[model samples]
Target chain A: EAGVVQSPRYKIIEKKQPVAFWCNPISGHNTLYWYRQNLGQGPELLIRYENEEAVDDSQLPKDRFSAERLKGVDSTLKIQPAELGDSAVYLCASKGNTEAFFGQGTRLTVV
Target chain B: DQQVKQNSPSLSVQEGRISILNCDYTNSMFDYFLWYKKYPAEGPTFLISISSIKDKNEDGRFTVFLNKSAKHLSLHIVPSQPGDSAVYFCAAGKSSGDKLTFGTGTRLAVRP
Candidate 1:
């Protein structure tokens, strides 16, 4: 089976521009997550979905960040008017609660 | 405040020696713990996991040990190799909470 897939492995945007990333989770996996990893730090969960509903989004910044898992198979995370502080790797992962399989991630650089 | 902590930022071990990584959590409600390994430019991959009731779980040369009373856990790699060098992360979660709290991570460098 194919692992989780993410598009646009790398992205560069202006400080005020908007950017979006896409994720396709492994087939049959029930849980999906979006994470942000800064340099020298472990991933921080930004949002989590169980099927089409977002079960956890407390860590997501509502002002500039939004995520949707339409129909539950694929997901999209968007950041509007990005800031320099947003430069980091955005990762998508899928699993069945305990163990997760991750995508390579999209490296976002806001200049 | 950081709920999960990995005090050691990095570790170096001989290729044939054992490598031990440690983690501590502030939440006693965490009923599950996991370890993940990540390489540069790649996302983390699940290494192993242990449930709260169990103190130890072993898979091949990798072993995870939990000390629930102390809210601490550890991962041990026996007969370590150069290929095993990577960043190790410890995560904790409750059965009811869908989100996981991750540690800062410890970089393990296994040298030949």
Candidate 2:
């Protein structure tokens, strides 16, 4: 089976510009997560979805970051007016029973 | 505050030797611990995992040891190879499906 899939392996945008990242979870997986990894740090959870509902998103920056999981299979994370600090790798993952598989991730560079 | 921490930023080991990466977590409620291996420009891949109820879990060359009393966990790779060189992250969660808190990661360089 295919693992989690993410679009645009890399993205570059100027500060104050909008950018979006996409993720398609593994088939039959009901849990999806979005995480951001900054340089020299581990991945931090941005949001999580159980099916089509966002069950946890407390770490998400509500002012500029937004995420949606439609049909409980695919998800999209958007950042409006991204700042230079927003440059990082965006990872998507899906869990089935125990283990969560991750995607290749989208590396965003905010200039 | 950082819930999980890998104090060692990097480690170097000779091929055919053992590599031990340590991690400590501050959350006592975390019941599951996992280790992930990551390469450059790639997402982390699950390496091994151990439940809070178990103290040790071994799989081939990788073994994970959890010490609930100390809130510490360590991953050991035996007979390390060049292919094993990568960043390793330690993560903990309350349950198998709960959100995991990760450590900063330890970069292991297995020199051949």
Candidate 3:
């Protein structure tokens, strides 16, 4: 089966602009997650979804970051008025009864 | 506070030798643990996992050992190969919550 898929493997945006990343999880997976990884650091959870419901998004920056999984099969993470600090790799993953599978991720750079 | 930590930022080992990576966690509630391998410019891939009930789990040449008393976990790669060179991250979670807390990660370089 195909692994999780993410679009726009790389993106560059100006500060104060808006940027969005998309993800398509593996088939039949019931859980999806969004994470951010900075240089020399591990990936950090930003949001999680069980089906269409966002179960945990406490770490998400509500002021500028938002995410949604309408049908639960795919998801999108958006950042408005993006700042240079927002530059990082945005990863999306899906999980079933076993381990979670991650996508190639979208590398976003804010200039 | 960071619950999971990988103290070593990087490690180097010869291809025919063994490579050991260590991780420590402060959360006793975490019942499931996993190791992930990541290459530059790509997402992390699941390597191995161990449950709280078992002290050890082995798959092929990779083995994961968990010590509940010490709240420590280690991943061992026997006869390490150059292909094994990558950043390894340790993650912990509870079976009920389905949320994983990840460590800072350790970069391993296997010399050929």
Q: Model 3 off-target regions past 4 Å?
A: none
lDDT ranking from best candidate downward: 2, 3, 1
| TM-score of every model versus the real structure | 0.98, 0.99, 0.98
**Poorest 10 consecutive residues by lDDT, candidate 3 chain B:** B92-101
Native-to-model Cα distance after best TM-score fit, residue A10 in candidate 1, in Å:
0.7
* Candidate 3's DockQ: 0.73
Model 1 C-alpha lDDT per residue in residues B1-112, reported as the tens digit of each score: 8999999999999999999999999988899999999999888998999999999999999999999989999999998999999999999888733677899999999999
Model 2: docking quality category: high
Distance from true position, residue B80, model 1, in Å? Answer: 0.5
Candidate 2 lDDT, tens digit per residue, A9-85?
A: 99999999999999999999999999999999999999999999999999999999999998888999999989999
DockQ of each: 0.72, 0.90, 0.73
**CA error at residue B18 for candidate 3, angstroms:** 0.7
Q: Which pairs clash inside model 2?
A: none
Q: Report the lDDT tens digits of candidate 3 across residue range A26-98.
A: 9999999999999988889999999999999999999999999998788999999899999999999999889
Model 1 chain B: worst 10 consecutive residues (lDDT sum): B92-101
- Ignoring the other chain, what TM-score does chain B have in each prediction? 0.97, 0.99, 0.98
Candidate 3 lDDT for residue A102 = 94
Query: Where does model 2 exceed 4 Å of error?
Result: none
Q: Candidate 3: lDDT of B92?
A: 94
